[model samples]
Target chain A: MDKDTLLDCHRRISPHIHRTPVFSSRSLNRMAGADMVFKCENFQRGGSFKPRGAVNAILCLTEEQQEKGVVTHSSGNFAQALSLAAGRIGVQAYIVMPSNAPQVKKNAVMEYGGEIIECDPTLAARESEAARIVKETGATFIHPSNDMDVIVGQGTACLELLEEEQNLHYVVAPVGGGGLIAGTALAAYYFGKGCAVVGGEPIAVDDAYRSLKSGKIESNKTTDTIADGLKTQLGDKNFPILQKHVESIVRVTESEIIEAMRLIWERMKIVVEPSSAVALAAVLKEREKFENQKVGIILSGGNVDFRFKGRP
Target chain B: MDKDTLLDCHRRISPHIHRTPVFSSRSLNRMAGADMVFKCENFQRGGSFKPRGAVNAILCLTEEQQEKGVVTHSSGNFAQALSLAAGRIGVQAYIVMPSNAPQVKKNAVMEYGGEIIECDPTLAARESEAARIVKETGATFIHPSNDMDVIVGQGTACLELLEEEQNLHYVVAPVGGGGLIAGTALAAYYFGKGCAVVGGEPIAVDDAYRSLKSGKIESNKTTDTIADGLKTQLGDKNFPILQKHVESIVRVTESEIIEAMRLIWERMKIVVEPSSAVALAAVLKEREKFENQKVGIILSGGNVDFRFKGRP
Candidate 1:
């Protein structure tokens, strides 16, 4: 997608989303040995950047299409994002999740007024069910990351950061389904003076990191990372964007992500989930390289169940 | 004690402290059935509103007095606040704490350049130690909540909240040493258009509530509450201020505080300590009273040991 389309998508979704705040920490700056601005998408509507894409996709649809509604299959933030975004604009959202998905996740979707269709716990089952729903109800199936409108919409966050701090040397985001980082890369390419876009991913599921090297989509054999959000593989639509515009991917360990997450929670006084911490972990891991440089980090989301671990 | 002093304190301390953001939560508003604005002093410099008072008190000192330095005895947010505030003004801070105080609290004070003087864990021991330090070094003793300058400094948070939204019906804050609520009461009295200021206290340490009722200072029989910050009884200076301008104090159970804390952490994506949650808990307890009205809450601090509770 071009910058013009990205700008247009930002305009379309601007009225629906929060222009999330960019928070700076002197203590965190001392730790990272760099000047860093955190774009707190954890405070975004639906508690993640997922709503940026979900809202854009829904808004781009025709009146007839909106009435038919939209559908997506996910067991994470996107489920709530689609539900909340669709509900905001007077559209019905069909969220397809694994039957074994946690009750908290199901409850959040329900709270957002989404209709949940539970399928067997498999990728094939999820895709097939989504397809069946699209066929039966004439609902549009919006992929969590791969769609063009969604990617452009997700780019608006980086657009905002760049607009706020135009002199940023680099922009970083955690690579989940490649939506946030892909869009971020494009925003930096178009708006930044010479800013490079970096992706942070868990070493346990370094599909995006490997995919860039392989010049193709790569899958993880094991999803053993604590950052559960980054387990998904990169998509065909966003992979080319990432490969062409993105600079590199930084891999961090589970313990490192947790440590970074704790630092942000303690110092910044903000609650960010594990996925968001990966980007800060990447910065902390390579502190010397970023010394005295201005960097922007997208805190992807803050939607974790507090019952298992009292603070989210 | 008056609007002029509070306004002067705000002006003097504004350069040293953060004008922390006021955040609103739709989920919280829905739950309370009212419009609530949270003055996020949890995100304030030093991770609490203590610095507002600390900085103002230090700055109000004469040049010679500042040169002599300042001292306080505490094992909580005040210890760090004094250290950081004094450090910012290039003054020495003597922080006397019980030997049994948490090592993390000690480290934070040290990080802020406070010289820690270890004393016994008793209140008498703390006061005697602080007295001895002042007697020897001639350092000005600054009470955490009992001083005139400090009370005026603490009032600035409410001043800012009122300045931002002048039509608030009620302002609520967790009462520790009664400084924040007392200041809030004065600010509301002088600035708010018919605004009523309320204090929230832990049922475990309902000294302020009893003090207000009995028209005299009262001690807590047991500091059984999880809100460690509110364990202190109202001092002579702030108690009278609280009695005069404060409407009433609301007492919340431990479980209620935890529930309110969780709702904020879950929905607002902000980290607030149990003490900060007390105010919101009080509001939730009296939901009908605040229904359809505009309310402001001071989130006192975000300084909590997550290592013990995993997350707060």
Candidate 2:
């Protein structure tokens, strides 16, 4: 994407995304042997950073397209983000989600007035449902990650992150469909820090890592882990962007993801979803390489369903 | 406090305190039976509303007094708030805490550059330790909840809460030493809400409630409950303020406190320390009174010890 488009995208959606706090992690820093700066996207609007892109994409649609409404297939943060953003603009949002998606997430989408269509978890079923919704409702299919506008909108978060501190050695984000990490990579590379951007994924669903290694997009057979937000196969528009920008993709074990989640909540006192923890988990596994390096991490969301009774 | 000083306190400290998010909980609204407007002071700097008064008090200090430094006695949010606020002004802070105070809180005080002295938990011990620190160092002793500047400073939170949306029928806060509730009462009352500010306290440490009923401050023989923050006697300063401004104090059972904390984390998806949950528990108990009424609640802090997993 051109610099002008990126700049305009920032202007288009500045009000919707939260300028979430950047917290210092003394414990995580010591463990990773790096100076850690946490960009708390977990605190962002709609409990994640998706609103940044959703707002930009929805607002930029032509009047005719706006009249047609918007449609997307997401069961988690994007569903709520797009629905909430669309709700604010007096536009309807039709969300297609796998029937197995968590109730809490579906409830949030409904709360924001998003019309939900249930589908099977398989890619073919999800795509078919989304296409049917678009055809039946005459709503524009707003791709959660694949659209250039959405990706650039996601890029604005890094703009804000670098605006505070531009000299980071590494920037990291948990990769779902590669939109956040790809956009984050573009900002980190453009912000001029000799910066390297890393995509963090679970070993259970390491499509991004496999894709990077094989020099092509890849998919996982099934997903397992507490971070449901990162289970999606890489999107078409985001795959090329990911290959072009991201330095590497790291896979973290399930146990390591939980440990990282607990550490972020306990030590940093910031609320983050398990997916966000993957970035920190990746950093912790390679302490030697990151030692004392200035690293910026994006905590992707805070929408956990468990009731932590303050005890194990 | 005079009206001009109250107005000035709002202006002087507006930059320091974050006007945190107000989350709308439909279920909480249905359950609490009120249109709940949750004022998230748990997101406040110093992880609570303590900094409002501390910053105001520090700013009220004269040039000579500011240079001499500040001191307070507590094992809770007060110690950290005072240290951070005083440190910001390049003033040395000498905090005295009971020897049995949590090591984590003591470490936070030290991390903020406060000179910590350990004493017993009693007010007599606190006074002696603080007096010695002040006597030796010539620093100004800022009481946690008693001073006028501090009270007015704490009032700003309510002022903003009311100003944001004025249909508030009741304002509820967790009462420990009574700094926040007292300040809330003054602000809510002064704002012409004709609203009564209620206090929510843990049943195990119901000194604040007993003290309010007896028309005097009371102390527990031995503090109980996992809510380490609220195990305290009402202050000489806070007691009179409570008597003048407070409507009534409600005691919450420990189980209710834990249940409310879980509900907040699970549904609202926010992390809160236990003391904050007392306000929620109180609202839950008196759900009928709040139904359909605009209710305001303060989430007091997020500074929780690892031992408690940051909740009760």
Candidate 3:
């Protein structure tokens, strides 16, 4: 997608999404030895940046498609996002979630006026359930991260970040289904002066890292990382954008992810999911490259089930 | 204390403290049945609003006193605040923390360059140790929440809140040792058009609530509340201000405190200590009083030792 596409997508979704604030901590800067600006999508609607894409995707649909409603298969932040976005837009959302999905996740979707269709805890079951819903209700199947509209919508986060921080030397984002990093790369490539885009991936599920090295989209052998959101493989639609605009993909271990997540929560005083911490983990893991430079990191989401095991 | 005292105190500490941002969530507004604004002292330096008072107290000290350094007997946020504030202002801080205080807290104090002198956890023991240190080193003993300078400094948070939310109908704060609520009451009295101040106290240690009715400072029989920061009783210094300007005091149960804390973490996506949640809990408990009215709540701090029981 081009600059106009991103701008138009942002304009369409602006009214529906929160223009979340950017946060920075001197202690975090000292730890990383760099001037860092964090775009906190953790505070975004549905507790993640997923709504940026979900809203834009739903809004871009044809009148007939909008009438038919939207459907998606996710047990994560995207389900809540799509549900909330659709509810706000006066469109019905059918979320096909695994029966084993957390009750909190189900409640969140239902709270946002989404109808949940439960299936077995497998990709095929989820896909089949979503397909059945689409066929039965004439619903538009909205991919969480692999669609053009979603990518353009997701890019708007980086677009807004760049608008506020014009001189950022590098922009970092977690590479999950590749929508966010791809969109981020495009935003940096077009809107930034010379900002480089980088992706942070879990070592356990290093599909994006392997894909970059192999010059093709690669699949993970196992999805065993603490960063649950980064387990999905890259898609063909966003892979080309990453290859063209992304500077590199950095892989962090599970412990590194937990450490980074804890540091952000403790130091920044904000709740962030482990997936979001991967970007900061990547930065701290390879501190030399970003030392003394202005870097921007996208804290993807904060939909974590945190239990304070202190006095209470 | 008056408006100018708070204004001047804010000016003095402005260079050393963070003018932490105000946060709100639509979901929270819906739950409380009021348009609520959260003065996020949780994001304040030292993870609490203590620094505002700590820095102001230190800056108000005489040149000779500053040279002699500062001492405080506490094992809470104030210790960290005093340590960090002193380190930033190039003054030595002698923190007389209880030997049983969390190791993490001690580490934080040391990281901020404070010299810690451990003592027995009892009140008398802490007092004697602090007194001995003051006699030995001539260090000024800064009370955590009972001094006039600290009261004025703490009032700056409410002052800043009022500055942003000019038409708030009421401002709520945790009672604690009475510094924050008393200062908040004073700020609302002077600066707000007609804003009333409210105090949120833990039901288990409802000394502040009882003191208001009895017209005397009262001590708690048992400090069994989950809101560890609010266990202390109101002090003589701040009791008069609370009686004069505070409209009412609302007590919340431990369950309510935990429920409120979880709501903030789950819906608002911010980490807040249980004491911080008490303000919001009070607001929710007294929802009918604040129905459709604009309310401001000062989230006291975010230093809770949170553990994520979810995956990773």
In candidate 2, how many Å is residue A2 off?
3.2
Model 1 Cα lDDT, one tens digit per residue, A1-312: 677888888888888899999999999999888999999999999899999999999999999999999999999999999999999999999999999999989998999899999999999999999999999999999999998778888899999999999999999999989888889999999999999999999999999999999888999999988898888988988999999999999999888898899898899999999999999999999887788899999999998777623322
True-contact fraction per candidate equals: 0.56, 0.29, 0.62
For candidate 3, the per-residue lDDT at B206 reads 97
Score residue A53 of candidate 2 by CA lDDT. Answer: 89
Candidate 2 at B71: error in angstroms?
6.6
Q: Provide the lDDT at B139 for model 1.
A: 98
Among these predictions, the greatest TM-score belongs to 1
* lDDT value, residue B26 of candidate 3: 88
Candidate 2 chain A lowest-lDDT run of ten: A303-312
Candidate 1 clashes between residue pairs 3 or more apart in a chain or in different chains: none
Each candidate's TM vs. the true structure?
0.98, 0.76, 0.96
DockQ of each: 0.57, 0.24, 0.57
Candidate rank order under DockQ = 3, 1, 2
lDDT of 3 by residue, A1-312 (tens): 577998899899999999999999999999999999999999888889999999999999998899999999998989999999999999999999999999989999999999999999999999999999989999999999999889888998899999999999999999999999988998999999899998999999999999999998899989898888989988989999999999999999988898899889888889899999999999999999999999999999999885646544
lDDT of 1 by residue, B22-91 (tens): 9999989999998999999999998999999999999999999999899999999999999999999999
- lDDT at residue A296 of model 2 (Cα atoms): 89
The 10 consecutive residues of candidate 3 chain B with the worst lDDT sum are: B303-312
